[model samples]
Target: MSTSPQKRKADDLDIELDLDEYVPYVPIKQRREAKFQKLASQRNIPEPQKENEPDDETEELVRAGPKANISLIDQAVEVKKQKLIEDSSKTDIEKKLEEEKAIMEAVAQRKLLASVQELAKGIIYTEPMKTTWRPPRHIRERAQADHDAIRQRYHILVEGEDTPPPIKHFRDMKFPSAILKYLKYKGIHRPTPIQVQGLPVVLAGRDMIGIAFTGSGKTLAFSLPLVMFALEEECKFPLIRGEGPIGMIVCPSRELARQTYEGISSMIDFLVRDGYPKLRHLLCIGGISMSDQQNVLSEGIHIVVATPGRLMDMLEKKKFNLDLCKYLCLDEADRMIDMGFEDDVRNIMSYFTSQRQTLLYSATMPKKIQDFARSALVKPVIVNVGRAGAANLDVIQEVEYVKQEAKIVYLLECLQKTPPPVLIFAENKNDVDDIHEYLLVKGVEAVAIHGGKSQEEREFAIRAFKEYKKDVLVASDVASKGLDFPDIQHVINYDMPKEIENYVHRIGRTGRSGKTGVATTFINMNCSEQILLDLKHLLREAKQRVPPVLEALEDPTEKFKDLSGGCMFCGGLGHRISECPKLDAQRRQQLGNISRGGGGAERGGGEY
Candidate 1:
């Protein structure tokens, strides 16, 4: 054991090393010693040298390898071998990353042209959508019956796909079948309209603009594609972790950001259940503690869900890095801009390279949003489920002029029979509160949500409204754009919106899910002619009937419901004279005949 030259030959070569491909900081002299150590380790040299030997192998693995400074030729040759081994590992990491970058290059470049090229893809409801010409009652029923049959047949025959183009390079990807099996188990055997179309373009690293109404599966559309890329590349991110952005998903509000995070978590759970277990993500939003989010980042995370302001705040604090990001998504893009987040968006995006894939989605895109999109996202695929003019065309439009004083009674009248769950919009916080209180006192299930509410309260209100604990949600404009209430069957403009665009958001809440919705605006007598003019213009743009009567009413006031008058029978304010105890019996007796529709009454129920 003392020293057989033959026995010592292999021991002389064993070494240990670990390397990263991107770092070029490793020096040259000690590289030979690394080679010898690697050779010895590979040959399993025994512990004759192990007793007092330092654990240099474990200590030096992440940094410069053993023999990093050794200059002797014999050790250098061993070190050279170690360096080669380290370099090879680095080379493998580099080669794999390069192939990913290369494979993704075409996708990245396509993003350069995606916006214009993808604008026309999902044109499901164009002029033809408007060609129904208000089918007659019988014809409508018959048409609906026919369509229902077709839809049911289609649902059964196909898994709601549009001949999904097979994934390119499917064999090259090392997908965990258990994940696929899990999806299959859940009958998610096929992707939805948005997913089937958006995934390929995203996987190719192209930017996309997703436009679909609520519940059309927009969340899964982008999330699945993101997962696909992360899994295929085994994306490096530190969660609770390391430094650098692997991905960022920006939503308009904390509510939406949290929703997206929860969804991604479930997807990860699903994948894990099927045998492919390792998946990591993060959630960042306005109300959450920055330190908590930063700690998660310290560990490194693969996916992050955040709103623009909070994400930017974290970015400024150096809690997250966007320079290394390969993917970026903007959910409810239009709403984000409306919330005055343009500056923050550009600031957060500035940290990302131009080569990153950017996916932006909204229910509707205005010119303002489009202009911002111009500077924000690269040429992105615009997957519009419906365009500006055609948005919510499936929804029906209605308007009713009511006296300011009679509004409550009229609302109660409207609600008396067959009341539908409604979204009532008001111009101010005061209005939201007043209207909300009235509804609650009237025994209607209702909740109020606005900027004044705490984040927790706001979230609770939203959940309560969604779960039907409340059938109506009285809110200010804050609830308009970012919300998606697919079951809202009616939207009432409790107060005529000051801006016409606000009216659009108000009514857009209803008539979701391709269901015909009813929106009634209580055009008060006080609304200015210009306000009326604006309403007309917007209605024209939306291509719906603007009530010939509303146009005809001058200084424009004809109350739709005449519920505010004195009790006509008795001529008592807010009550019938017969019901008023203040009246003398003789007076009551004298007016009794007239009040009861026996003497002074006119025909057709318009008597006084």
Candidate 2:
């Protein structure tokens, strides 16, 4: 008998099992028994004597001795069998478990769909079309006259030395043909409208805040000009052989930094071939082993794309020189603030010299962000792609007043009707997990991403979502930031956010660049008056169609309370674990009553 005890597992290594799609073969036990019996029969050497067989040592020895051969047969298994055993020692079995679990998930998804379909048939009603009275010819003429007069007032195109010349062609900028060639290889020969308008302004060393929807090739909009500016500076300072990193791009999230780097990798690679071999790009984000990052930084870099917090930590540790950085791009301007990185961003900005060219881009610009931009940039050449009182006309906004209990029903309907690769945003961490489970149960392919997950888990989830291994992506605010997932065609807000700012960021995930898309939100009793008001304010700002019913719940008070827990009703979360009501209540009760109770409260009462 073996006396050795099994090794324990580490707690942080989240182990999960999935038995979905489990095409199980017969147990190894069956094989063991069959092989043992076959060997016994072969070794028996039957004696064909009549009557009763004599009880002899031969028979006794035969049974026991034959069993010894079974061990040898076990060794005859394939190399793959041995490899699986060996590999198990290095990796946790949780990954395989997850795969198996997916089979169950598929079943659950189907059930969810069926139930949702039934509910959808009842709740989804056709909205009646509004009939408006026709306008008179005089009214139409008056409107045209007013439009012309407003255009004339704003059309006073003053000729100033600071104003950049209108762009005619990409070649006019004179970027190295090698870089241009690389851009062409990536099928990005044409610069975006923002790139055409923003590049010239950025290249002029002017600060700029460009508001454009997602997927408009904003990375190139900021990067191409920054690269050109740096290249020009290098030519002027030829004597200084090795100047440290000249440009830095600060994003709000790791995924964004990663995507941004990929977006500009070929262009940077082309620079390396042009003999400015010192041209090196660095990436810094959470969840990565920092040893290699530190080692690479010791030698220095020409460009660094990083999330704000990690970048701040690297700076405090003096990882590299930042005094020379002359270019900065806040790639996801709105997300940085929404992700609570505004402070980190401001701190990073302080490190760079005021002369650095600053560029900020976001789908929506709020007052807080405007204030930040005003302070951060010089008299910036503000380029607004946004129309007055219009919020991404390309995106269709929808809201559903779903019953609190009928969310699952509504969710199923949305999933079935929505196009594939839809992004579903939840307000809390648990909701991400729960919805991910529900979708899997309903037979819809899906995955979840949150801070609770490790780096590897997050990467795998995104890959599955992007590669169509999954149809829906269930995520918390973690997905709301600078991250980019190109295949996402629809965005569903399962829960409304507390801040109007957050709502803007959430919707911005879709209709990126110039692509048309749709955003749908859940509004019900769970949606508080404050949330409703915030939505109305946003709608008014965007000049969207607002129903008369929306005006009924005019929130008289600002209610961003930073509640102790996510509202159990809506699942909206914005606070830390310590602040949770359930946890707090448990702690309070535990502290109030001693485990021993009054049985030990004898002599001195409660006084010590």
Candidate 3:
């Protein structure tokens, strides 16, 4: 087939093919073979084969070639054998048998070598190594205690008639063997608290609102249910494009949508290999060709992970239908609401049946999110892993009351001190770009991402940052939420965010997956008062040291000593201005001058 541009040109040129003649149309394969043979003949590569070679000609050649030379007959025989070996008519079973024989031979040779080594070492036999080790009784007891403490600490509220029990281990749950194998392959032995608690609620097909910190495995908590549901349907019926997708994941941003897609896609491949129905998924985001997305939708998909805007676009374009969607997940719902995607999300949800199982996952649940959940979900089990606005306990927060002009200096000092892979978040795109350029000028490997950047540039920046090709990533709030970036050692707030919740999200970028990380914020009195108060409270909750300025801002009464009159010079408000010693020397000098001037300029020394 011609390329699209070529086809368009042909259409514009009014080209037509005439099929009236009896000229036999040649297959593309035969035409290409003929063309290549002509080229080979030109190059004198054994003169090309003729199209109409008589069968009797080969017999005549065999009878006469022996008279010419005996080696020619041997050559012909060898060529015939090679042609037979290369024949396309070979059965798949024959190929499989050959591969199996080769593999068995290799295994036997390895075994023989190992046995020879054992004999040379004078060893009679060897026992297999133990690959599994159970935790000691004390360790289990401690872990149980910790789990109980965690459950007690977090305000995990559930309202359901029959809630499934929390799983102690992934193996204890009745997940498919494929999922279990994937877990083992990923070396995820222990489940996070959110997973332990939320998995059962979701697997039971209950509407759930899971509030967990970033990188706490909430993706898996919700994704596993979608995957399991798809798997269950796979055993019952074949899922085709005509049926639309079985699961739909909506995230606020394209990066987050891609992250969720990747998380679910990994399991899809494994499940398909483990005898499940072939699963197909598509990422629906803007900043790409709509025609390409429409093409994919025409082919059908089993799962659609998309940002809200692009999904709405596709829905309006009639690219795909959601009638068959059984699982609906809204990841980072709070962020979606914050980014003003609530209407889009609501509109998209309207396309699906109200009976579809809904799962909303967010890091924090403000009143807006709570109301959104109530309106969209049905009796969702509100699972709060920690305090709603609390920063991750794994992050060590440091605050400095730096002047606005000196922020860059402080940032540079921090970059010099901290390890690589630092993330610097700014409040706006201009700041992000400025910091990125400044870092580059200073020879720091830095990349930037923001709404101002093109989609390709943003993707490249994200990729570079993730791969450590760039050590520092300067970004606006776009990178602060939902995106799963790993091994970020430090997060520096070059400019304090306007919202307290955003502060939590920015620092939450680091200190993820139970890893300890550092977050440094350059704050000044010029920052918003509400953010200052919120930062103080958050720092106190996280058990970090609060600066005196922040503490004073948090509680003005405690820092207040006296509000009475003070020395005008020092402005201490601790002494009267008249008795202030700062004026004594000036008064003495004035009196001496007046005396020397014969009292003509005698000063009124009452207040002097």
lDDT of each: 0.58, 0.61, 0.69
- TM-score on alpha carbons, each prediction: 0.56, 0.60, 0.65
- Among these predictions, the greatest TM-score belongs to 3
| Tens-place lDDT digits, model 1, residues 1-608 | 39888767766555322232245656774676577678878997432223466675643442344444544565658768987887777654365445434533431222212222123352111111011112234433555446335334323111222212222222222235655655565446555445544554565555667666544557766776677666544533223346544677887666667767876787788777765636667777776566665555666666778877667767778776765577778776665544235445556656654356777776655543554464445545565454432335656676777898898668776554335577888888887888889988989898897767778787788889888888888887767664567677777788776544456666777775456777777877777554565465446556878777545635211221233322222122222222322223324553765788665212110000
lDDT of 2 by residue, 1-608 (tens): 64433322332222322344456788886777677678868998443222366566644444345553335455456446877887777533354344434533442221111113333453322221111212234433555456335324433121123444434346655566877777777767666656665665676666777765555666787877666655655565631323457788887666677777776676767777876544456787888877866645666566788877778887888777677887778876755543235445656765654256667887655433455455555566666554311345566787777776778668888876557989999888888898888888878888898777887898798878878888888887777765666656689999887554457667777777557777888887777565576576556555677656676664432243323222221112332222223234434554555564722112110000
Give the per-residue lDDT of model 3 (tens digit) for 96-175: 44654553344223122112333355543222111112333443455545645556654454544444455567765667
Clashing residue pair totals per candidate (backbone < 3 A): 39, 25, 1
Candidate 1: residue 134 Cα off by (Å): 43
Query: What does candidate 2 score on TM?
Result: 0.60
**Model 1 ranges with Cα > 4 A deviation:** 1-196, 212-216, 235-240, 290-295, 335-339, 416-420, 526-544, 549-608
CA lDDT, candidate 3, residue 586: 41
Task: Tell me, by lDDT, which candidate is best.
Answer: 3
Error of 1 at 76 (Å): 87
Ranking of candidates on TM-score, top first: 3, 2, 1
Candidate order by lDDT, highest to lowest?
Answer: 3, 2, 1
